[model samples]
Target: MKRICAWCQTSLGEVSSNIHSEQAITHGICDICLNNLFADRDIDFIPFLNSLSAPVILIDDNNTYLSANSKALDVLAKDHQFLKQKRTGDVFTCENAHLEGGCGHTNRCGGCQMLQLINDTYEGKDSFDHVPVTLFQKHGDVRHKLDLELTTEKVNGLVLMRIDSHK
Candidate 1:
């Protein structure tokens, strides 16, 4: 089987396989493409993120917000400083994040589709697209339900989560 870079289509190499197949191809990102996609030393971090058209946020393996694009900051109604180091639930104002255990530590988090998606992406699972997510946010005394669709891709040890649609 041949392994090829999914982004640039560069041939990585061939793997030994006992089962014969006619030029089977496996997909993966090459080092050059990965660096180009996530790390461009010439470009500023915020600017690189802002270059994307969608509302995107970069999260670490632990699901902490490392940075967010301008569109995401606007959509979330928060600044970069406020979102940095915060978890998904906290950034989205999920009601459970305010509980004793907080965010991922809460019982509700186990059933949270958003958290599950993030975890799956961080663990090197295939990227997700247009996955539906529901969040219960507490605003003063009232709790409001927010519905969202998200797409996630893992790159350079971080997950880029894009908010596809929300209401």
Candidate 2:
């Protein structure tokens, strides 16, 4: 199998394998590409995210939201101050998040597809598109069921999670 940089299509290296008859290609970002993509952080931070049409949120390994684009803010109905450093459940107003232990620590968290997708992408250093997710959101005294499709990409040290669609 061959590992290639997804952005520049540059070959990183090849992996020895005897399982497959045909050579397969795996995608990942190279160090140079990573640096180049994030070098101009000051100017490109918000603009880069804003350029994306989907509602995108940048999250760390701990599930802390680092940043969100305008689309994401509009969808989430929250500003940067409310999202920054907040956990996924808290940001989305998940009912389980308000319980003891909070967010990922709650018993119900185990079945959360969105959290699983984020963790899987981060751990595997892979990207996933159009993954179905169902979230139980709480607002005032009502609990609402949200069906959504999510796309996640591992960008450097952050996971770019996009709300592809919602219903």
- Cα displacement (Å) at residue 111, model 2: 1.3
RMSD of 2: 6.5
lDDT of 2 by residue, 43-131 (tens): 34566577556688888889888788899999989998877778999878888988988889988888888789989988974547788
Going through the candidates in the order shown, the clash numbers are 0, 0
TM-score against native, each model = 0.76, 0.75
- Give the residue spans of candidate 1 off by over 4 A: 1-44
**lDDT, each prediction:** 0.75, 0.74
